[model samples]
Target: MTQAPPELPLHMRRDHFDPVAELAEVRESEGVRRVTSTFGMPAWLVARHDDVRDVLADATRFSNASQLAFSLPDDPRSAEEKRKALAGQMLATDPPDHTRLRRFLTPEFTVRRMRRLEPRIVEIVDQHLDAMEAAGSPADLVPSFALPIPSLVICELLGVPYADRDEFQHRTARQLDLSIPMPERIALQREGRAYMEKLVAGAKADPGEDMLGMLVREHGADGLSTAEAQDGAAEITDDELAGLASLLLVAGHETTSNMLGLGTLALLRHPDQLALVRDDPDAIVPAVEELMRWLSIVHTGVARTTTQDVEIAGQHIPKGELVLCALPSANRDPSFIDDPDTLDVRRGSMGHIAFGHGVHHCLGAPLARMEMRIAFPALLKRFPDLASALPFDEIPFRAYHFIYGLHSLPVTW
Candidate 1:
């Protein structure tokens, strides 16, 4: 097992809604600096917006499929089995394979497809709001509203039984937590895979209209047409299906839920911006974008490896080196936008790499945007006097997780 590196100040730190002060200093001075990853590997941390964008857009140069292994707990699975398990996750693949998987999944996440989900999404938000209202004030909005709306939506979309949400959600939370022991995290990963396996089996038995079923119908045993096969659609193994479903189930809800929780807290902190979001219907769209950029819930954009020696920000990075882009730092760089630290809902849409940049960008970004656009306004409208139940300083932030967010946002009306 690889030993953990000596503790160092990580660039990914978030002080409530803002990145740690050191991150800003590093961004301004170094731009591109060598840093150690949590997994104990050395990586070049890119902080400038242009440099980060360059690394992300040029996948051929920065390969996402680089085999940098984080220390995992002891498990029975052979190295080959573990590699196979990771194969179906789009984030872990590069180029032709990533392109192929994304091509099959893109239709489900298209703007049109996400738009069709709007009515249902609005209804879901309202239902959660109603429940929150019924529960009265001083509610922990994290579980009450933030987590459930996207969880329910993704569950229905992926054909995961909503009744089993608690189990899967718990597994996801544990898996992403950096504080959790490696063994526990590994166990959670297995548990999640097992749950997904069952869903894959059901999809195989009788394909429903959901995304999982679509995968089965088009690429599984349901059989594809000659044109479908000729177009590069091929039958996916059950393990691959399970891997895909697990990624969708976990990624689909976790990030958005955290955004909902953390974004609300951010708005509460900036009441003036909150007012803009609450009262101005036209501001909602850009508000969501600004919040995504401001909060930068995902601290480290996807990690990549240098495919070849490359120069970034005047620094020479050798081939096969780990590269980690600081999304929060890049988004907050002065070069990216004016007053990058301030959360201005009316700032209009800036080309912020919140959902990331390039081919490996987030697939559920459209759905996430829709959820927030509906959710923030609806929550504010419902509880016109909504404010934090606990003091701002008391709200716990998930600083150690791969995704940055509030652990619980206790609020009152």
Candidate 2:
């Protein structure tokens, strides 16, 4: 039989609720260590909180755009297709390029905007909760509750047909799974782009009130009246529109869905914390923050390529190298917090790099927080005695994937 690939490198390893013990050991002993990526590319893993933050903060030294230059050997896409793939991707660009795209999107994602969508989000959460109750106990929370809320929210926000969610969700999940062959993942990515391109065409024909419509109205080829052009509204190509929409569609749902699924599991495992969130209105906010800090679900953050020779924690790394920040490890570093391993929902508003840091911090942070803030407390209040249907060990974890989360969480109340 053909041998299985080696286990995920230490930076990506997690033991359910915590980073692996060895990861902690490495963080404390050596702030930066070399490791092979899931794709078998060699990289420097930055583990300490400070060093990771510095790597994330200094985009000039660590270039996101440079990292995009490194492509999978198995990828068969033409140079043009690959260029289209990176178009308008905020995470894959640096400085002015990222700033330009982000400026158009920032207005759409502000805290004020999230407030306007709050009622609809609450409606979506309740709709799912009602469905879960009607379906009775032992519901797989992953599909029944955790998955649909954010998926529906993103679908509505992006003006994608909710009817097509199953197809897009399947595409994104398969594409993000590191275990899937790289070529197959690239194909799924292409399918997603094709799907979004069709939607972009529709938005161009007639803009709706959704985000895609907003983009088309403000940045589409025919966009920007002379006055608006002066205000920085520039005409964007169809590929950029499709690329931006595709990025939002994948990210807006995937990260939050996993947070819901994995966070619910974390809460169920700690009943005391669960009760705090369920019983007290104030507790839910802090609880969400703590859970996010504890769960740092994005596995290793986006890889950065070094622009020049750099020294981190007294270790010298030469120019043009890949640097990976261990988000979970950095979040759990003892120096970053007291009793770093323990879960305490009462810790209010600590700075955690779970959503990443600096210029590339997650743009959907407000929307995600709003969803979780609404969904978590609502689920707990709806099912006060919520629980795991199986032993912890029996629950499946998405261990080898780029994002860390539960594959399915069987629950009962």
lDDT, each prediction? 0.84, 0.87
- Candidate 2 accuracy as TM-score: 0.96
Instruction: Report the C-alpha displacement of residue 342, candidate 1, in angstroms.
Output: 1.1
- Which runs in model 1 stand beyond 4 Å of their true positions? 1-9, 68-76, 221-233
lDDT at residue 100 of model 2 (Cα atoms) = 78
In model 2, what is the error at residue 177, expressed in angstroms? 0.4
lDDT of 1 by residue, 105-134 (tens): 888999999889999999999999999888
lDDT of 2 by residue, 242-268 (tens): 878898998976799999999999888
- Angstrom error at residue 149, model 1: 0.5
Clashes of each: 0, 0
TM-score of every candidate relative to the true structure: 0.94, 0.96
| Top candidate when judged by TM-score against the true structure | 2
For candidate 2, the lDDT comes to 0.87
